[model samples]
Target: MSFTLAIVGRPNVGKSTLFNRLVGKRLALVDDQPGVTRDLREGDARLGDLRFTVIDTAGLEEVTDESLQGRMRRLTERAVDMADICLFLVDARTGITPTDEMFAEILRKRADHVILGANKAEGRAGESGVLDAYALGLGEPLRLSAEHGEGMDELYHILRPVADEFSERAEADAPETDLDVSDDAPEDFTPSAKRPLQVAVIGRPNAGKSTLINTILGEDRLLTGPEAGITRDAISVSLNWLGTPTRIFDTAGMRKKARVTDKLEKLSVSDGLRAVRFAEVVVVLLDAAIPFEQQDLRIADFAETEGRAVVVAVNKWDLEEDKQDKLKALRTGFEKLLPQLRGAPLVTVSAITGKGLDRLHDAVLRAHEVWNRRISTARLNQWLGAMVEAHPPPAPGGKRIKLRYATQAKTRPPGFVFMCSHPEDLPASYTRYLVNGLRDHFDMPGTPIRVFMRSQNDKNPFKGRKKAPPSKLRKHLQGRKAD
Candidate 1:
């Protein structure tokens, strides 16, 4: 029964700050730079006893064309149409400008219940702007300092009646039912709903990360154009993707570290890296015409090193002339360049035309399945014996190494620990041999496989110690008679 409120305004008007305040979490990235938010982000919000849904949208722009700013403006206008109420934010220090007036007029035409808010109106410097907000004919403006947590009481008061009205309407419209004094449950709540799968899309600049996300969403939800690095903040959107609940993050294109000098770009890259860390499946998007650049390899390698399930998606595939030949070349190059990711799915997709999306979805799911693949101890031991017999462990310095046992220590980018003699002396080449053996034998291709070597001697608590003298056990035995 709670109403949905949308915060809409021009760039850098503190809308995201107010949204963070309302949600009581730093879900949206905030910066001094304008146009930080590029998509619609929704959060469950609470103000005192009133609970509702709040949406933080991209900043309103004046352009109405096909440019990026125009697209952003259209998206913001869409939010106005969708929300039950609109909180129009204006920069009080800057005073009511032509953009604020335009936004007000738009809200007057579209929004059902509009609440004018003069943000950053804490000191006397913004007092004139707060007064000017009233002249827009939107009634009294709620003076707010979203960052400083001022005027929230006024915001709550203004929204309380609207919430109550929604509650009453919902109650009146509901069918009568038997009531129990202790029974408190939502009528439409489903307890078995699974958590959404986390997927992050990353690549170099202009690799169609945003376009792919938009195609999947089947709408112009994200601000996308020909611009490189159009996306920042690593915005995440939720959807039921082909019967699977998924939370997919759209990240800013990450360039080489040497090229990332700007402070904002550094933050954006950091955010993208964070998204990759939390993501279960990372889609390394690439340009079809220029696939597998050094940067692309690094991005995919980062995901692999982080133990994330990886899917290499070559975007703009629709532009390719010879599809079959190009696909063969791509596969050949993938195998030759990235032996660690052998057998991992490399799906060709067109973010614009939505070509081969279904195949990409299947590939992603398959990679995740392999990432979480687990083997029984008996099976692992059997496989280890065969692998050792096929290629015996090398002897070093006249000492032979013995492979005692192998067991999977973790799933989700499956990690295994091997108990053996002289594990420290084992060469990394042998480890790679075992890892590749495991991938081919267990059918766990493409996903990163972690192998850890542990020595049987390592289990001893007195390791690396000279015992400091005779053991206390020996002393006690000496003291004891012939017991």
Candidate 2:
């Protein structure tokens, strides 16, 4: 029954500061810059008995000439459309401006309920701006100093009425029938309070996946040796990394299906694939001696395609005498062989001697963080703007292709949806351009990246398409007449 409120205003008006104060968490990055908050940030909020969802938005800017504005519009519109109410924040010290009026006009057209807020209204200096906010015709502005934690009682009163109405409606629609809460409790199925992050360490048989995992766990949990196929079953172990619980799976080394003859080997390979599906992050190990072998690249590609966050670990670094030469060779191999997963992290480590183990952990953590990373619509578009300016989308049908908007449709492998005028006309090279741009901008080199193209002309049904096979579509289209 809690309502959703979006805090929106011009840049440097303390929107993020107020958001941090309201949420009681420093989730949003706060800086003394105009456009530090480029994306919309959502968090649960509370003030006294009133509880609701609050969204922190980027400073509203009038940008028509910028290519990134389209993406920002999509993001802002989504937030405004979803929210039941909005809190339009203004700097009481700065007074009102043309920018504030412009935002008021936009919000007046969009939001059902808009509450004007006069921030930094603690002293005489802010009184003029507080009075100026009333001119917008939104209503009497709530005065408060968010940083000093003043005027909270007024804020509570302002929001409590809305909270009560929502709660009353929710109660009116509630079901009256009661049932036993623990009726289906199992005798032996005690649910653990924590869910461990499932991670799969997979590569060619000779690659030191088991060794690296054993190093991570700081124990010889999995049997390790020189021989291939020594570990057949996909053995999993529960462990903690810096207090975060994780389930690391040591999958059996996968070989070419043509060479996988025995029924048992086939089952093992199937189990490995199953592990890949279950994993949230996959560490694709590669032997430094023979880095980026056809099979190693294939494993990395599979991880990316399956939407699993991938990290490449080049094992046995201690044995390599020419470190720089080997690393250069490895990077070249990755860029050439697995261009699809262009910026995937490639951590060089000695799994046998435990050198660079800490770096490997850092790299894995960074990759995981990036996998879960969500950029504000504003920031993404800003970055997108720079990218487009650097290299525009290719020409199609004798005209320039326009990439209208981009947003993260999903993540885990960090999938993005780029809405455009011509999805089919967007060349693969252009997609690569964006992918490489993302990798470089985000410092997520050597990690799997995915960008999905969708036409703004039609609704994209991302669902069920995962199950649809391209071969089937080709088969159905074979010998078909042009429409």
- The TM-scores of all predictions, comma-separated, are 0.88, 0.52
Cα displacement (Å) at residue 287, model 2: 2.0
Cα lDDT listed for each candidate: 0.89, 0.78
- Least accurate 10 contiguous residues by lDDT in model 2: 185-194
Which residue pairs clash within candidate 1? none
lDDT of 1 at 170: 100
- Candidate 2 RMSD to the real structure: 28.2
lDDT of 1 by residue, 1-483 (tens): 888999999999998899989999887788999998887888889899999999998988889898888888888888889899999999999999998888788889898899999999999989999999999999999999998999999899899999999999999999987975563645421112355678999999999988899899898878788888888778888887777778899988999999999888888899889989989999999899999899999998899999998999999998999999999999999999888788889999999899899998888888877887889999999999999999989999978999999999988779999999999889899999999999889899899999999988667777787647788898899889666
> Candidate 1: lDDT of 408?
96
Sequence-dependent TM-score of model 1 = 0.88
> Candidate 2 at residue 64, lDDT?
51
- List RMSD in Å for every model shown: 5.5, 28.2
